[model samples]
Target: MTDQQRAKPLRALVYGDVDLNIIDGSAIWAQSMTQGLAAAGCEVTLLLKAPVTTDRLVAPLDGAPGVTLRRPYEEKLLSDLGPRGLTPDQAVTLMTRLDAEERFDLVVVRGRRLASIAAQFEALAGRLWTYLTDVPQNVAEMTSTAVSELTDIAVASRFLLCQTEELRCFLESAVPAACGKSVLFPPVVVVPEGVSGPGAPSERLRLVYTGKFAPRWNTLEMTELPAALDKRGVAAELHMIGDKIHRDSPEWAKRMAKALEGTPDVRWHGGKPRAEALRLSAECDIGLSWRAPEMDASLELSTKVLELGALGLPVVLNRTPMHEDLLGPDYPLFADGDVDAVADTLTLAADPGIYGEAAERCRAAAARFTLEKAAERLRGYLDLAHPTAPAGTDPQRPLKVVIAGHDLKFFTRLADHLMSLPGLEVRLDEWDGLRDHDQYRSRELAAWADVVICEWCGPNALFYSQHKRPGQRLVVRLHRFELYAEWPRKLDIDKVDAIICVSPHYASLTRELASWPADKVVTLPNWVDDRQLDRPKLPGAEFTLGMIGIAPSRKRLDRGLEVLAELRRRDPRYTLAVKSKQPWDYWWIWNRPEEREYYERVYRTVQRDPLLAGGVVFDPFGPDVATWLRRVGFMLSTSDDESFHLAPAECAASGGVPAVLSWPGADTIYSRRWLHDDTAAMADAIHGIVSEDRFDAARLAAKAEITGNYALERVCSLWTDLIVDGTVPEPVDLQGAIAA
Candidate 1:
C-alpha cells in the first residue's frame, strides 16, 4: 500500500473522564473529537470512565461507521466505586485488556484523571497525547517524571498555553522536550450545513441559553434579562436548554427555579441531546453565555459560545480577553455579565441591521473552531516525535518563583516582569483558600517553588508555612487590611524567610504584630508603569480633585467628601470625582451595621446638600486608572491609615499633584510638605496650587518624583535581586525609606 493508503484507517483510542451522554462541555468535546477523528479516516474507540447515565440521553454513537464506544465500568459499578468514577487501577486494567486484544496506534487522553491512567500504560507512552480542558495545575498534579512520559499535550486556548508554560516552569518538567508537540486548539463543535442567513426583524427578540444553571454561570441574571427587557418596552423571550439546575449545585438550582417560576417569557426545555440542542439554538435570534469571569474563565474558552455561533447565532457573552481573541475587537454584542447589560445587548440585537452584522461575524468566528479544523491541528502536533529543543538550565537553573495571593493584579504584573527577567521562572497561585481548599494542590505548588511569596497574610501564607519543603525560602507580604484581620496573628512566622511590606511604616507595624525577626521584614515600594500613567491633563483639570477607592470606611471617604464640600464652597468648579464602586454596591461594607450607618450618613449628606450633591461625582471603577486621573488636577489620599497609598503615586505619575491627608502612616509615604492636617487644610492646599498658577510646576514636580522613585523598571529590578538572587538588604528606618 502507498503511504497515504497505509495512513488511512489508523486505529485510535479517545479517553475521557466524563460519560459520552452527559450534557456538559467535556462530554460534547469528547464526542465531537471522536467523530472528527473518525471522519479523518481513523477507526476510533472512545474509552469513557463510566457508562451513560439513565437520566441523560445516550450519545448517538452506536453503530457508527468507523467508531466504537466503550466504558471501563457500568453506571451501577461506578456508584459502588464512589464519587471518582473509575480508579486508575481499573482504567489500567481495562485499557491493558483492550490493547492485548488489538494494539492501538495512538492514545488520546482527555482530562487529568484519564491522563494519570494513561501515564501508567507504559506500552502507550510513545503515542500518548493528553488534552487539558481545565487549568493545568488543577488538572495535573503529576511529578516531572510522569509529565516527561507524555509524547504531546494539547491545550484548549492560548491562555491555557501560557498557563501550561508557567506550570512546566514551576515543575521543572520536560515541557521543553515536548515543545512542538504542544498545540492550542480551542473546544470545537460541528458547524451546521447551509446555515440560514440572518432572519428578518421580528417584533420580539428571541434569546437562548444552553448550559448549567449554577450560580457561577450567572443563570439567575440570565433568566432576569427578559423581565428587564419587558420594563424597557422591548418584547423578548428566553429559551433555556439545559437541566433545571446544575447537578453540582442543587441549592443554587432550587433558588434559581423559585426565582424564575414567576417569569412568564422564560421557557425551560431541560436537557437535550447535542444535535437537538444545536437545532434549538438555530431557531433563537441570539445566544447567551453571560457568566462571572472566575474559575479559569479567563484562560479557558467557553465551548457553549462556540456551539451557539456554529449554529449561526450571535452570542451575548461577557466581554473578556479570551472572547476578544476569538471574535474581533469590535464584536458588538458583548455584556458585562449583568442582567441590564445582557438586556441592553439583546435590545440592540433586536434591530435587523445590527443583528445581521453580528450574525455574520459570529458565524465567521465560529468557522475557525470547527471540529475538522481542530482535528487537523491535532494531527500536526502528533506528527512531531521530538518536537521542541530542550530548554537550557546552565549557570544555576532559573529561580522558580511562585506568587500565592487572593487579589493577584499587582502580583500578576510583577510575575510578568519576573518572567521577562534573565533567570526567573514565575508561576501565579491565585487561590483565595476560602472557596477552593485543595491542600494537595497547594502542597504540590509549594514543593515546586524555590521561593514562594504569599501576597496576603491569610490562608495562603498559612498553607505555605505548613507545607513548604526544606531549604525552600518563604516570603509573606502583609498589606494594610491584613493587619486588622485575625490571619496576621494566625500566620506561622517561623517558616517565613522574609516579609515584604509596601512601606517602612507597614514593615514596622508588621514586625511589631507578627513574631518574625525584625531583620526579616523589608520594605519594597509598589511599582507603577510611568508610560501607562503620565497622560496630558484635561482642560480645566486644575479645579478637579480625584479619589480612587471609597467602599471601605478606612478610606475616610466622608472626610474626602468634607474636603470636597469645603473646596466647592471656595469654587463650584472644584469638583470631587470619586473613581470607585458606589458604597451601596459593596456587600462587605453595606452588610455591616456600623459601616452601613456611616455610608448612609455620608449618602444623606450628598443628598441633603445641593453643593455636595452637584460637586461630588461618583464614577465607577474602570481599568484605565491613568486615563481617569488625567481629568483631575490633584489626587487626594484622605484615608484613616495606609501602608503605601498607590492612588497618590499613580496620580503623581499622571501629572496630578498629590494632596495627602495626615493619617498615621501617610507621613511615612508622602512628603510632609503635601500632607495636610485636616480637610480644610487639604482644600486650602488645592486652592493655593490653583490660585498661585503653580499647578503646572507642582504637577511636573509630582511626576518627576514618582518617575524617579517608583518607576516599573526600577521596582522590577529590586524585586529580581530580592526574589531571584536571594539578596537580603538591611531594613531602613521608616522615615528615611519613605523619604527615599
Candidate 2:
C-alpha cells in the first residue's frame, strides 16, 4: 500500500477480560491500548466486559476523538446486573453481535478463552489478534494438550501478540505454528509531563510498589524491606498501592492484609486511579518490583517496572535476563528477589552516585517504551495484517493468484510478499519433483485462479499453458536451467501471456529459443530483502570475503581461493569465508571424476599454499544469510556463467561490496565498477579499497545500486502490477548496464 492509503483510519475492535472500573495492570492496559490504537490511526471501539460504576480510571477515555467506549450495561438486559462483569461466553456473544452490525478491520482480544471462543465464530475468522498473557510460562508447563490448544488458537487468529521476547520465543518453541505469526507487543508506558528526577540526599529513602497484591508478587515480602533497610542503617518508607489481593491462599491473604494494616514505617494507599498512583509514586525515591522465586522464571515482564521508570523512579527488581536487557547490565539496583538482597540494593541505591546512575538508566530505557513508540509498532503490524489496497484496486475482493513449482526456494519470499499485499490472495501448489505434481491440486488451483504464475518453465508451465481457462492469464518464469531443457520447447507459447526472465541475458536467450513475441518477454531480477540484510558490519569485516554455493565446480571455487591467496600475499589480514554444501553431498556431481578431481586439487592447494593456509573457512549452509552477511565485507561472484547470481545483490544490499569476475553478461547486470577482468584484478581492487579507506564508500555505492534496482518492495510492486492489472514492466536494455 502507498503512504496516502495508509493515512486512512482502520476500524479496530478491542476487548479485554478486565474491569475498567477496577485499577490494575490489565485494566490499565485496556484503557491505554484503546488510546494507543486510536493514536495509531485506528478508530477504536472498546467493548467493556464490566459495568462502569466509576469513571476515575475511565475518565481519560471519555469523549476522546476516534475512540468509542461501550460498557456492558449499555444493553437494557445487562443494566440491572450486579457488580460483576459479563462472563467469557457473554463477551464473545456480544463481540459477535457488534461485528455483524459493522465489520471491524481487526479485533484485539485480550484473554485466551475469550479469544478461543471468538475464533470459533464464523464472523470473527481471520480477524482476531490474540494477545495471550497467560500462556505456559515455562518449558515444563508446555504439555501436549496445552500446545494443541495454543496451536488451534494460532491457526484461527490473524496475529498472536506476545508481551515480551521471552514469551514470544517460548510460545513459538511450544507451538511451531505461532513462529511467523507472533509479534512482540511489550508493555507500553505513558510517560507523564515533567517527571521529578532524583531527590536530594535525605535521611529517609522512600520505596513504592503499585499493582495488585499477591503472594507471587511478593507484596508481603516487600513489607519486610523497610524493616530490613532499617537494620542496614538506611532509613526507608514502603508505600504500597492497590487493594485487590489474590485469594489463592487465605492465610497469605490475611497476613498481607494485616501487614498493610499496621506495619511500622509502611503506608498503604488502597487502590487509586492510575494517574494518582503515578503521582504518588513520583514522590518516592525508588520503585519496588521484587517478586517470589516461583515468578522469577516467568517469561512475562511487569508493566509496573516501566510505569515506575516512566515516573523517573529507579526500580529494584529481579536480575532476570529480560530486566538486565531493559536496564543495562551495570544497573546497580537489581535485587535477587529476597528481602536481604532487596534491602542491600536499597542501601546501595541510597548513595547519591549509585542513585544518579540508576535514575539515568531508567529514564533512558523508559523512552523506548513510550506511548508514541507503541503506537508506531502497532501501526506497522496492522499494516502487515490488514493492508490498504493500491490506488484503483478493490480491497473487498482480492485477486486470487496461484504459484505452482517443484523447488520454490527462489519464489517463497516473493509468494510471502504477495500474500501480505492487499488486493491479492496467493496459494502455492507444491510439487514433489521437477515433473511430479499433484495434477488434481494443480487443476484445482488453475480453475480457482485469476492468474497463474509457473516457476522454472517446467512441466507445470507446460501443463498450465495447455489447460489455460478462458479469461485466466498465464505467466511463466524461465531460469537458466529451463532454457537448456526440452520443457520450454514443448510449451504452447500462444497460451502464455508473459514470460519472465531473471536477467536480460536469459531473456534474450529465451526469446531466441522460443517463438514468444518480443513484448511478451520481460526481465525481472531477483529481489533482495534489503531491510532484512542491512545490519551493522562486524569487527574486521573489511578483511573477510564471502563465497557461496560451490557445488558442481561451475561456481569457480578455485578462482575464489586464488583471489584470497593473492590478496593475503599483499595483506595477511585477508581471509575467505565459504558457506556451501560439500560436493560429496551431491551424488550426481560427486560421482563424476572431473568434479572430484577439481575439488581435490582445490583442497590440496589450500593446504599446501602458505598464503591460503588457515585462511579459508567453511561454514554450514543455511537460510540465515542475513546474519551471516554481517561478517562478509566482500562477496565473490566468480562463477563461470550465471543468468543472475543473486549472492552479489544480496551482499550489496547487506552493505558489502561485490568483487565480481567479468563473466559473460556480468557487465550487463552489475555496475562496471564492481566487475573485474580476472581473479588478480579483483584481489587488487579489494586491496585498494582497504588501503585507501575506500571500503565504506564502495559499500555504500554497491548498496545503492542493489536497493535502487532490486529491493523487495520495488520488485513486488512490479509483480503486483503484472498479476493484478496485466501490466508488463518496461523491458531492460541487455547491451547496457541492467541496473540503470
Candidate 3:
C-alpha cells in the first residue's frame, strides 16, 4: 500500500438491487459488501438501481446500519433497453460517478451490466474491485472480458448473470491487485437475515421452486420428484414462484404442465414473493434445481440452491460446480440432468438417512450468511477503505405505518418521507392481479388492512369496494390517475376516513361531487423543499417547455401545446417539452386512427395549432422532480375533472408558474364561479397565466405554502394516530360522516 493513500480513510461503494423483491445471490453479495465493509471498518455507501418503471418511485430501502443508499438512474439504463437489460454506456456512466465521488478504495459492482461499468472503473486502475457473481462458464464472454480488466478480486457467482463467454473471461483474467481473497463462489445462505421466525405450515406439504423457467435450470422435471416421493409414502407438493420469462407464450405453461403430468405428489401450486419464496423454500423438506443442458449450463448454480441452503433444506441437482461449491461436504451430485435421476433423489430424500446429512450441513452454513455475517464483512471492507467512521445516526425519526395496496410500488417520495417519520410502521400488499367484481365484492385483502391508499384503476376498484369496517380508514390519493378512467366513479366514497388531496383545488372538487362531505376531505399538496426545487434545468431552458405528466384525455397535453403556441407567437425560438415517450394505452391511442385523431384534435385545437409543443420526452429520474420542473418557465394543467392536481403544484415548486385550466369539475370550488365563459376563455386564461413573468415567484411561494400542509410528518401522524387507529377527531362540523 502507498504510504500517502493509506493515511486517508478508504471508502468502498457497493451497488446492487436492494429492493425487497430484489432477490438472488448477487443482491445478497452486494448487501454483504455494504454491511460487511461497514463492520469490517470502511466508509461504505451502497448504491441501488431502480428495477421498475423509471418515472415511478418505489419504497425506501431500510439500509444497512451506518451505510448510505441511492437509486442512480443513468436514464439510458431505462427507455433504451427493451427489457433485455442495461446498455454498456449507461452502466459506465453509473460506475464512473461512483468512482469519481472521492477516490473510492474499492468499488463493488454486482449483477447485470458488468462490461462498460467495470471497464470505466478499471480505467481508473488500482481504486476499485470487481466482485463478479458468476462462475467462469456461466456469464457471456464479452462481459467477463470487460470485468477482468478491472480485477480478479472475488467471484461469488452463484446466481450468475449472462452466459458462458462472460463467465470465462471474468474467471481467467488475473488481477491480484483487485483483491487478495480466493473466490467465495456464491454465498450459500442457510438462513437469510430478516425472515420472520419460521413460516407455520399450512395443510399442504408445500414444496417450491424459486427461479424462472430457463433452459439453464428447468425444475419442471423435478415435479416428478414429489410424485416419486409421494409414491414412497411422502405426502408433499410443488409450487412455482416467478414471472418465468416465457409466461407470455401459452406454449411454456403447456410444456410445464406436460412435465408435471404423471408427477402425483406435485401440483403446480403457483408463484410467490421473493421473501415468501424464501419462506416456502424453508418450509419444504427438499428444494429442487433442475437445469437443462446448455453450453454453460452445467457451470450454473441456482438461486433456489442458496435459498434452500439458507433455509437448511437438502438440494437435489445436476452435477455443477455451483452445487459442488455450495454443497461442500454434504454434496448431493446427480450426474445426469434427467427425470430419472430426479426421481431417484426424491426416493433417497424419502429415506432421511440419504438427505439428513446434507440438511445438517446446510444448517451449519446458514449462520455464515445471516444478515449479521454480511454486516461484519461489510465493516471490514469499509474500515480498510475509510479508516475513520462518520457519525452514525438518522436525524429524521421514522414513522411506523403499514402499506396496504395492490401490487403498487408502495413507495413514493411522499411515502418514503412518511415511512421515515417517527413512530410509524409500513407494509404494502404488492399483489394486485385480481378480478374486479361488484362494489360489495372487492378484494379479500382489505379485511386485514389498517389503511386503504391506492392509485385507482379498473382493477383498483376491487380494493375500493371491499367493505371497510367503521373502524377502518380509507384515504384515496387523487394524483393524475383520476383522468379518463372508470376508477374515480367506481370508488366507494362512503367508507373513507379522511380525504387528502395533493392539491387544494382537487380537494375542492370533492365538495362538488355531493357524494362526499366537504369537512372530511382536505388539501395535502405534493411538496418539495426550496433547496430541491432549485436544481439546474436541462440545457437551454427557454426552448424547453416541460410537461412531465401524461394521460391524453385529460393531463393537459393540449394546454401545454396552447401555452407553447402563445410563447411561439411571442417568441419563435420557444419549444414545448413533455415527459411522455408514448401515448397512454399506446396500442389503443398510438395505433388506432380514431384514437389517434381524437388525441391530435384535442392537442391541435387547444395547443398544437398555437404552439408546436407536447410529445413524449422521457423524464430524467434525477435527484429531484423539480430539476425537470424548472426546465420550463411555465407548467400547465387542463383536465376535465380533477380530485387534486399534482403536476401543476410540482411545477410551481420547481420555481415555475403553474397556469391551470378551470374545467367543470377542475376542483370542487372551480365551477362557473371560478372560471369565465367556456373552453376558449380557459385557454386564454392559461396563455395569460404563463406568458407573463409577473405570476412566477408568487405562485411558487404559494405552492411551497400548500406542500408544507402535506409535509411527511403531518400526513404520517394523521395516518398513525388517527386514520389507522380510528381515532376520529371531535369535528367542529359533525354533519358530515367520513367514508372510505
Candidate 4:
C-alpha cells in the first residue's frame, strides 16, 4: 500500500455469481464494475462463475487495456474441478490459488456465501472488497444467524461496497461490524457517445423497458399500458426488449409468450446487446421501470431508471423514496405499480412542458453515476487506503480506530479517508439514534480501538468517556446542536482527550459552556471532497438559484422567496430550486403552530404572486447533492443564524458561487466577499455578476476559496494527524492561513 506500489497499476480480481451470457442486472453490474476498476488504473482479471458459452458479454473487455477475461469453463484446472457453475468452496479454492500466484492488490467478490467463504482465508482477508446485494434487506429478515455471518464477513473484508446509503445504514445498524467499513458503490452507467434524438417528445408516445421479464418485475402487466394509454386518447407504443422470461410456472410462461406475440402497438425486440438497447432507449419518448410494491421495500435501486436517464428519456417508475431522491418529487412521472397509475403518469409525461422537465431531471441524475465518475471514486478510495506504504513492506500492526455516532452521514467520508490512510484499521459503531446506541457493540469496539472518535457530542460521548480504557485516545466533535443540550454537562471532560468544533465561534462557545481549557477545545472545520464535488455546470445554470434544506421555519424560506421574486422580476428566466424535505414531513417541527403558520404563509405567497408562481420548484430531499448542484449556479444561504454552514462551501466546490447572508459569526468561516447583509444585497450581487458576465470568474474564485480553505485532503490529513499521532492541528484562518 505504498506510493511506489501505487505508481504501478493495481491488480484487481473480480468474480460474481451471474452468468455473463445472460443479460441481467447482476451480470451487467459485474461487467460495469470490472471496466470501472480498469478505468481507475487497475489491471483487472474478471473471472466467470458460470460456464461461458457466448463471447457476447466478455467481448468488450477481451482486448481492452489492463483487463483480462478468465473463463474457468475453458481452463484445464477449473474444468477438471467443475463442469458447470463453480461452487462456493471451489471458487474460494480457485481464488486462493490465484492469490498465491498473481498476488492481487484488490479482490472484489459479489455473492454472499462466496464472500463469507473467502473471508475465512487469512491470505485474502486484507484485500477483499465484498459486495453483497442479496442480503436480508429489512430488520425482520435480519435474523441472528444472518447478522452473525455478515459480522464475520464485515470484520475480515477491507471494505463492504454498498449500492445505496439506505442499505449501508441498515447493514451497519443490524450488523454492527460493518459500520465504518462500507462505501457507496452505486451502478455505473456508460452512456453511449454520439447518440442523439429529437429534443422533444414525438406526437405518438414511444415507451420502452429493457432487461429480463419476471413476475416481480411486473413486465407482464406492462403489456397492458398501451391499451390503457389508448383509452385515454393518447397514441402510444410499448417496446419490450429481453430474451429471458419467467418460466417457473407454465401458466406464467404461456401468458408471457402470448404478450410477446407482436401487435401493432406492442413490439418485442427480444434481446439486443446492452449498447443497442440503450441506443433504442434514446430514441424512445419514455422509459418504464414501475414494479411491484414488494420491490419498493428492497434497498436496491433500479439501474434501468439511471440508464434511461442517461439516454435523456423521461422514466415513469415507482414513486418510492429512492426514486424520489434520484429525481425530485416534482419529476412529473412517478406512479404506483397499477397500470392505470402508470398510464396516467405517461399521459402527464406526454405533455411537452412536463416531458422536457422530466428529461432534464433524468439527465442530471444520471450524470453523477457515469463510468468516468465511478473510476474517479474508486481511485480516490484506493489512494486514501494506501497513502504511502510499499506493496510488501511489513509495517507495525495498523492502528485500530472506531468512530461511534448515530448519524455519520457528515462524517462517513472522513471515516473513509481515515480508513484509506496507511497503518490505520477503521471500524464504526453505529448508534440507533441521537440518544440510542448499541452499548454492547460500542463497548466491544471501544475495547479494540487505539483511538475512538465520537462524531457528535451525544450519548456515545458520555458512554465512551465513562468507559475510557487506559492509554486509549478519545476525541469528540461538537456541532452546534449539542452546545444547547445537556449531553456536554453529563460528559466526563477529564477522560476525554480533545473536543473538535467546526468553527472558532463554536469553539469559543464550547470552551465557555464546558469551562474547558483552550488546548482541550480545538477547531477543525467540516471538509468538502473537492474532487467529488468538482463537476460541469448545466446549460443555463446561471439563471437557476438553489437553496438546500429549508425546513423548521427559521431557515428563512420567506427571505429566499423574496430574493427569487426580485431576480425573476428583473429576469423572468430566473428560477429558484428548493432542495429539501417539506416542513410537514418533519413531524416534530410541523407540530409547532408557528412553524405551520410560517410555511402556510409561504405557500400562500407562492400561489398568489405571479412572479413566483411558476418560478419556485420544490425538489425532494436526497443524497445526490453533488450532481444536483450542477443545475444550481448560485447557492443561497439565507438562514437567520448559523454555525458553519457547509452548503455554500459544497456549492463552491461544485464550481457554483455561494451567496451567503451575513449571519452572526459568518465572517469567521467564510470570506467576506461571499457574505451579504440582507436578501436585497444577495440578489443584487447575483444579478450584478450575471449581467456583467463575470459568473464564470466569480464561480472559479469561490471554488478556489473552498479548495484553499477547506480542501478534504488537507482537512483529512489534520484529523489523521490528531488520530494517529495525537498532534492537534491548528485552526485554519478565513484569510487563507493557519492560526498560530
User: What are the per-residue Cα lDDT tens digits for candidate 1 across 457-535?
Assistant: 7878888898878889998878787787888788777788888898878888887877668888888888876755655
Model 3, 512-607: lDDT tens digits are: 653567776655444334433543343345355566656646565665565556566666666766655446446655776765776777654644
Best model number under TM-score: 2
| lDDT assessment of candidate 2 | 0.84
Candidate with the greatest lDDT versus the true structure = 4
Candidate RMSDs in Å, in order, are 16.4, 5.9, 26.1, 10.8
Cα deviation at 632, candidate 3, in Å, is 70
**Quick one: how many clashes does candidate 3 have?**
77
Lowest summed lDDT window (length 10), candidate 1: 155-164
Error of 3 at 650 (Å): 65
Off by over 4 Å in 2: 1-8, 53-56, 73-90, 117-122, 169-174, 194-203, 292-298, 392-451, 467-473, 503-520, 527-711, 725-740
- TM per prediction: 0.47, 0.76, 0.41, 0.60
Q: State the weakest 10-residue window (summed lDDT) of model 4.
A: 386-395
| CA-lDDT, candidates in order | 0.70, 0.84, 0.49, 0.85
Instruction: List, in order, the clash count of every candidate structure.
Output: 0, 0, 77, 5
What tens digits encode model 2's per-residue C-alpha lDDT throughout 568-686?
Answer: 98889999999988999999999999999999999999899989888999987765576678789999999999998989989999899998998877776787889999999999999
